[model samples]
Target: MQVYCTKQHANNGSNRFCTQCGEPLPLAVGQVIDNRYQIIRQLGQGGFGRTYLAEDKNQFHQTCVLKEFAPQVKEPQDLQKAKELFEREANVLKKLQHPQIPRFHTSLQVKLGNKDFFLLVQDYVDGDDYSQLLEQRQSHGKTFSEEEVTTLLRQILPVLSYIHSLDVVHRDISPDNLILRSSDHLPMLIDFGGVKQLPASQGFWFTKLAGNHTLLGKKGYAPEEQLRQGKVYLNSDLYSLAVTILVLLTGKEPQKLYDSYQGLWYWGKEINVSPQLEAVLKKMLAYKPSDRYQTAEQILKNLPLLTATKPPTTHLTKLKTMIVAPGRQRANALVSKFHNKTQAVAKSIPLPVWIRPFAVSLGGTALVVLTGAGTWAVVNAVIRSVTSITIPSISLPEIPQLPNPLGQPVSDKGTKDNTQIISRRQQLEIPEVFFIKMVDELFYTSKPELKGRSLTSKAEDTALRNEWYDVASNFLDKLEQANLSTATRQKLGNYRSQDYEIWRRQARAGQLGNYTISQLNKDTNEKFDRLFPGQQRGKLNQQTFGQIWYAIAADQVSKLKSSN
Candidate 1:
């Protein structure tokens, strides 16, 4: 039961003035105004008013928020004009009936001690605001994860859609205005002191209000037009929402997330997330009203996998579901097949007895054991199979149900397939000679039959190189298809531009020198050592050099077997 002065200094309930700053104190606690609502304590202070936690005595002591409309105007006509604006805006907000939004009760004016108090009554949501939640996380050296932010956006966008459909725009949409409700863990929109109806019939009445028209939003969060000219568009709230998300993600203020000099949000590069999500966020934070997403529905549509009607049945299905891009589906199918086999092997093995007791304690949904080949187990919580049974690792030879890269049957035979020959006149985009030359540098390994020789002659080298190309072509054909997700495609593109393309260019120009060790990733570095055990980088024969690059590409493509 306390009041605060204009300087936000707390004062005793009985004091009419601040003892420290000597400014007029706000409504004292225990003071019942309008004989129905009892003042409790100050909750917050804003540009237009001070919010108090109050009790609706008429409704069995239920808690509510009373927002005081304290405009700094003295003239009789101006005061009357402010009252009309407040009532008009409140009536518009009263039409909103969203569950996530606090229900607006009514506006009341009461005279207590030679002064007037205009109060807005709303449902008091009992939970921490996002700002407070962020503070708690920051104290522990953490911020809202990308997943949390996306979930928040998914929930809050619908509320925005509901309100915008009613032609109401929330001018202020910072993290402070949103509350994570304790009753249902849903984000609740709490403030409407700055809500404005956007119908053409309203004729921009907000501009006429005194002491609060330009004070609707916080700096850095609000877009330029809204802050500078007191003009707000449907997308203005979206800009503020993006800023709020950036703040939650980086735990930094809006000023730090954005670069005022460059007039762009530099936070995108700082955070590691999907490029698709970054693009959507960037568009929402666009400086121009027209450049931004005009409606929440538009943003939902453009969001990364948010509007998907159903989940993917398989890794291949997921890749095809996404928009087509070059090299998108290239390594996905190959990686999925390999990953599934390894996962099956990893799961089918028997668990140790020492860990068995710990696993069974986790409950029934812990581990689901699927027996036999071509099947996999899902690890839910802990692995606690009571019986000790050993399941041998399964080898899957052919996936007949799935189509091959070129619509041919996948052979049970290993990588070397001499019968699969490319017809030159088949109008194939891939040149057979390209693969032949790509692997030409690979010398033959020492065979038991060819005892003393460790390297193949020119003619023997040519035959082995051609055989290797046939296998490489299978991967190339899939990569050229148009069904990969943008992320997968971009990853493959980087491998080509930064690795494969550089090697190919050097080899083709006959200027291949010592390969750049610094440019090689960990996998490539290891593979290089295995291929040329005791040889220096610049001293390898052309055959071994070609084999190393091919192995590098194969290894990279195989790594994607686990990627979506």
Candidate 2:
């Protein structure tokens, strides 16, 4: 028997890890989890846990997704915190009840060998994520049309509105999380791992649980506030959603499309969309959360009515060509079929005088005359009169001079002037109700900045420079609430005190002998050089290196604190 790893590498059933990548392969085929769900295959894995395709044997072989709670944290306190977050995910899913959202089944714990494995079962959504769909489209040299994307937004925005009404924020909204269902062709919002319930009031504070500070969301797709301070609001999801649409439009990731230095999105020239749609998308992708649309409802209300593009030749011109050309027999057959149907209906019930004149006149017009000047106008007038029947209007080309029997050329400039008049008339034909609806759906734009209230007491900048981990962490939190600049927020977010602590532990265990400074990435190495310009990189072991790294980070924090 063979089993597939999370990366979809085939392995022998008895193998503990993937042969190709060496990633731990937890569940083997036919392994019964919680005596109910039998593991079929590993679907995917992330930082949180591995998700598996499973069969609920007790429930008539129903397919479901079993999300395993397998955080890499080793400490008991961290493990307990991870468990609480895992349970919170299940609770969030249980509260959500929408057709577009996968239904939460149950959560169970089972012992696999000596370790306790926790599992969350949810209704298996059978479809490809938007990321996969976009890839498929790109492979064929195609992308989603504006109409298709607008329809997608219309379908998914209501789902966001529903969740937001329940006070639940989907923190992670990206192409990977949106699945296009095979059954209905509608997108389903999946993966509630980053789901956070909004506090009832600004004053109501919930106790900060362990692992709560751990950033949860994709980096490039997540807003600055979310990536920097782990702060997620209702509009945070909206920001990610806008990034997702931009990715689909340009067939490029958010990182590539956005100018991080200039803080501007360069998506306008890449794809052709309406000015209205572009404006709305820009607001949604605003740098500050307060500048974005406050709610999904506002987005829906402001969304413009999508209009079809004008064709080079009108439908009436095509109909005229079809009537006069060799395909005249086909057109006559269609008209004859309609005439016979009208006759059959007339025999059962008397035709009205208005309808009878139009029905009889259709037969009197010769095939050549039907393609002539006044005939097109007569057909259009009849079409407009039958508004009660709800028939679609046929677009007509501008009237051109009929060809003379002697075949004299007609003036082209006269035809050009007539086309402009017809175009203006068509524009005026649109109902006033459309404009009224657009006016009624104007967007709300009164969102205020989310800066918290000022602190009465202040801490000295020297305290942050003391090289204490507890002090630096508390200072970072205070700086976040103070509404610091983007550069300052980024500096604080990238601070690697955690990395220094890991090195400290490795040094205490005498494992520093096996490590080298060269293993650090280019960015980290550059940062190290800037901090300790004279220090020898080769001689800096984990113990000595951690000490210097810690001191440098502390000093930088102190400088930022004093400047603010």
Candidate 3:
């Protein structure tokens, strides 16, 4: 990594100790704060303070970073100012949630031997700063594509939009503050320490003698207003943004262009550029901030106008005609459409022999010949019968009474009595299992559609009705292992009222089988298994069980009984 400054340059340059106070720098790795954040490594050190990548630990919590006031360069006359700036940066960070902007979580002080102060914790970003990106591209003799430039501008302009909405101007906009992902090439803006708010007046601002010529911003790109302690607004940053884009496109620094033109920052011919784009860039680099856009939003509105011009090629004109002209011509379109439809029909026609028409004619002639032969045979038989004499009359005997049904007669009354007794016994047995199965059937009524319903005549007994409904549902589940018919299953279901009675009645009798019906009012695991017997093979809900059970009992009980 780049060493921003040795701990010694604490105030201005480089050194292991704080430069102002000459106190030993307290910045280090693995320091804990508020019993939460653990410092990882120093990210960078600036005039304000040192920033460290840290991990947050609520309980040895997690990895993150905290940027806090640098160990005060002892007796630096501007310590109070530095401290205010640090807190403000933290405050601005805490208020923002833009993805392009880093997130600030909390503030706290770390106390060690006669000292304590806060370290600002922020979400870590994982990409090279824009300057490194530029250098990497230059190393390979490459430049960003128009699409790539457009993408970078679009990603961060929204951040600018948001910043502008808050009435704050990010006075600094340059390569180092923009991060382009090494993987996807998406851009994000970082570092808001340079922001200045627009005041209540038409053109009020906060300005100072800024820039150490360090990488926060570059020379020629910074508007004169910012360079000379003059009031600046959104336009000031837009100028730098335009310059940055131009540099990315042409791979030439704005200062080189300005120096080549005797300190005129505008791009005319100092940078190898297209006339169309250079014209737009000239307005941005025009020295006076007012001569450029008034806001980033205005810049965004005008970006689409910088599109690449078409080449003056006769060949392209001919190709465009071939592709687009036919679609517009009625005659050519008819020919193209006809050819497609005919080709489709040719593919669908079946083999000729299977569909030949003559076979039906041959079958019709064969049937006619067979009918003629049958008619001749019948005519001959009629002649022979008419020629023959009539025979004497004879009477056929009637069938004797069928053997007394199995040679025994039953007394109808006696049969009726036996059947009645058998029927009553069967009715009870039938209902026993049917009621149980009814419970199983009731479960389906617990469908999502019926979740909160309680549509019964006995509304006052909704609780009781639901109670038994649950018992029935659970009981039917346990009854599965019992070797019983559909009727028995239904009986178990219908018997929830019986089980509820039993449950409330005994409050003592536990298990009729592997599970006790009382579990419906007991713990979740038992109730869940009964409500959903195959639950072990499905998902378990520790928290939702009671709610799910109540829903089931309320909606599904009546429907299941009706089905039974």
Candidate 4:
């Protein structure tokens, strides 16, 4: 096992000192910590401790990131206090659940040689951070476009909104902490080591925790209040995010863009953007916390052309807390809430078999109609578990008679002619909400425990494959029947095909199941939250589950572009 010393000299695992420099090595490759994670190499170091890339041997040897907590405190009591505070903060960090944020697994306390080390384990995100991406662009004599930065802000602000609503401040939102995930080409927020939680009800706990005076956050990116007083507000992250955008836009470091003597930002001279975006960025970079946009949602609302981008499904609000139960009770609760909410607009709409999970299932038949324009509709059928528990055998339901929204006669194939459908659709001016729901519901389904269980027989596998094919066919048939505009039809059809192909591929690999609708939105968003929270200026607004559909589709498009 190779280990590097402070002077960058390599040494053997058993060697205490480097053969050339005689510097001590804290850890070595192949060293297992806490009998689970095996260190691969050192990633980096900061004021607190170093980061290491490791693999969890117990979990199929999955790669993960390990952050060590080695604070510089002389007194033993101070070190103990710091460790206690770190553990408490880790507990809070564990609650963060978002696709863009790395999942915090657990914390550990272990001894290496004579020192006690605390470590936090998290899922390893494979991607280059924005800082690194900027350097790559600089090598090509280019910088991030205003459109790219605008897209970045629009995507990441919702993440900030999610965490900030839970009363947790990232405290660090620089380009270095924002990674562009390779899997989806979406900007992922990483490195929560500097997160600060300021729960209003736990004032005393916060006071004691804040007494550490660790001075978190980067020097140039952090706002004045955070750097000087060690105080963090939700908007503190916004201030740092704006700085990052300027850095990416100008291809200049933060210090170069700012005039320290005059206490002003002169990044505008380096690059130009739209007046609306410039105004939003300027407001976000305000020196004083109160003078800036208060929350991430504020910045999202004021962002130029955000409303024109897509459906009104922005998830910038606080989610209502929900309880997750098992069996029919859980299924009923989810379907009941969605049924009542969408009843007004969704009149006895015969939902296709594939999207039945997004509507209310009456015995064997599923019927649904959505109410609010942006409301996410959920429908779950109570499929009794198979007694053998080997492979689920869900019998496909027949397609019901179609209800012509145009009140036109349907042909034998269960669809009006394209001319009639388009003419009537134009007269009514109906948006593609149904199409959006169809694509988005694919991801909202729950995952059944199929781990370590293979199909009992090849016949069962073939049966499941046929079921998936039938579902895809039904989806295409539904799209054809809708006769949407060519652009909408192709976009939604591609999404459905993308998802269907993935499931089919998983089946070929012996990893497919008849999963039901997930009660927790698969933990994407909080359940039972009001679909709409009004259009107040500064308040948070909830995003419908349907929004995830487009977000995924957009991500797929981005990845395709990157690959090209």
Candidate number achieving the greatest TM-score relative to the actual structure: 4
Q: Per-residue lDDT of 372-447 in model 4, one digit per residue for the tens?
A: 1112222233122222111112111111111112111122243323333333322332223232223222212222
Q: lDDT of candidate 1 vs native? A: 0.51
Runs in model 2 deviating more than 4 A are: 1-23, 72-75, 195-214, 308-564
By lDDT rank, best first, the candidates go 1, 4, 2, 3
lDDT of every predicted structure (CA atoms): 0.51, 0.50, 0.41, 0.51
Clashing pairs in 4: 317-541, 342-371, 346-369, 346-370, 358-379, 359-379
What range of 10 consecutive residues in model 4 has the weakest lDDT sum? 328-337
Taking every candidate in turn, the Cα RMSD to the unseen true structure, in Å, is 25.9, 28.7, 35.6, 20.3
Clashing pairs for predicted structure model 1, backbone only: 328-484, 335-561, 336-561, 441-542, 441-543, 442-543
What lDDT score goes with residue 141 in model 3?
A: 64
lDDT of 3 at 274: 56
User: Using alpha carbons, what is the TM-score of model 2?
Assistant: 0.51
- With a 3 Å backbone cut-off (N, CA, C), the pairs that clash in candidate 2 are none
Model 4 lDDT, residue 177, Cα: 92
Task: In angstroms, give how far residue 291 of model 1 lies from its true place.
Answer: 1.4
